[model samples]
Target: MDRHNVELNRERPLATPTDLASDAVRDIGAGLNGLLADVFALYLKTKNFHWHMSGPHFRDYHLLLDEHGSQIFEMTDEIAERGRKLGATSLRSIGHISRLQRILDNDSDFVSPEDMLSELRDDNKQLVAILRQLHEMTSSYNDHATTSVIENWIDEAERRSWFLFEMTRRSL
Candidate 1:
């Protein structure tokens, strides 16, 4: 291929045709990629807590975290694919995810079970908020498909947060 063609190919790899305008593609792709990064971060953190879980509630908390981790991990592929379907490039590396992720990692040597549950609950709440924002943005751009998926994600995140909240509740 000629240099100009090569440059064009380099700019857009695996591009998919979409009705959305370039601005819509860029904006929605950015939102989806950032959401994907947060989902991956949350997934790893959930797994970390699950692996490190201990105490009288070990079995319950461990199982819960494992389930949550799986759910969070499941969102990554859909988010990335949605971005690609919008004719934009998806996240290409760990560094890209790290740069875009809003969710903070828990790197403590040890975190108490209660602290782990509480932290995860808060993170899920934050994820729900992010999903809501993305839903609004996508809807405004007339991207009904993306907004529809975000609605489901928002529900899932809220459910996870509710579960964590109940687990961490202290009877008085």
Candidate 2:
């Protein structure tokens, strides 16, 4: 056999053991996985509110929810890519998200705007907390890039949650 062929045969698969190494990379990968789940949950919740929102503020709330959903969905893809870059598997499917997500599904049949806002606020707060925790872990592992990403995400989630809370409070 040609030497090149032999070398190719000896190469490890992208998903194999050789692709995995570095404690900092592993920490970033795990954090990215968890962050992906949270982003997916946030996307779904925003879409739910966008689809079902009613009352006097329906137009504004619908638009806001849709925007929020899009933002979260974009973040989901970014985090998944970050995971792959970290030499880890990215959670790309709904099944993977469900398995990894800490946030509970919102399955209410008839949801009030207030209820939706409250749920979103709670979920965002939870996401922010998780991201901050993950940031700490990643920082300990010297994964500065991943830590920075999570920190930005946490800030965005917290701001969105506060906005939603304020809107709901004004309505009350």
Candidate 3:
């Protein structure tokens, strides 16, 4: 079924219980939606960079972007599922994702490999910050499942950021 159909047929109060209050689940789901949007945006940007990447490091940059894009895309499903598990309707469409996303898009015809790497690194760092903020929220709510997922996400985002930093680094 489509998102609209799913929206019209949502399971209220959640089928499963985790002891979290309904309000808490709703609040956490809202936050996860934002993360979902950001992850989607970053995924697209990473794929765009993968497609447009060119220069001396063409092969290496292309492969790196592809890998990072895959990782980012992977998060979208988990984030959305988490929201659903929390008794939320979750994301509706690309428009919905676009509305919640914070990552700045680059529509330039050509962005240098280094710039692509740098932009993605910054975006990933922003995601890490978002995850950390959500981590605090989850902790407060005693949402250990959400906290566990966010911790893994933070590690992945940090790794992505670290890789980008290393690739763009210039020794003195």
Estimate TM-scores for all models: 0.92, 0.86, 0.89
Which pairs clash (backbone N, Cα, C closer than 3 Å) in model 2? none
Model 2 stretches with alpha carbons more than 4 Å out: 1-12, 15-21, 170-172
Q: Candidate 2: global Cα-lDDT?
A: 0.81
Distance from true location, Cα of 128 in model 2, Å: 0.4
Task: Let me know the TM-score candidate 1 reaches against the reference structure.
Answer: 0.92
lDDT value, residue 16 of candidate 2: 24
lDDT: worst 10-residue window of model 3: 8-17
Better of 1 and 2 by lDDT: 1
lDDT of 3 by residue, 1-172 (tens): 7886566457443444457898888789889999988898899999999998888889988998898888889888899898777776688999999898888788998887778889988999999999999999988999999999999999999999999989878720
- TM-score winner between candidates 1 and 3: 1
Tell me how far the alpha carbon of residue 136 in candidate 2 is from the true structure, in angstroms, after superposition. 0.3
* Ordering by lDDT: 1, 3, 2
Q: What does the lDDT read for residue 62 in candidate 2?
A: 93
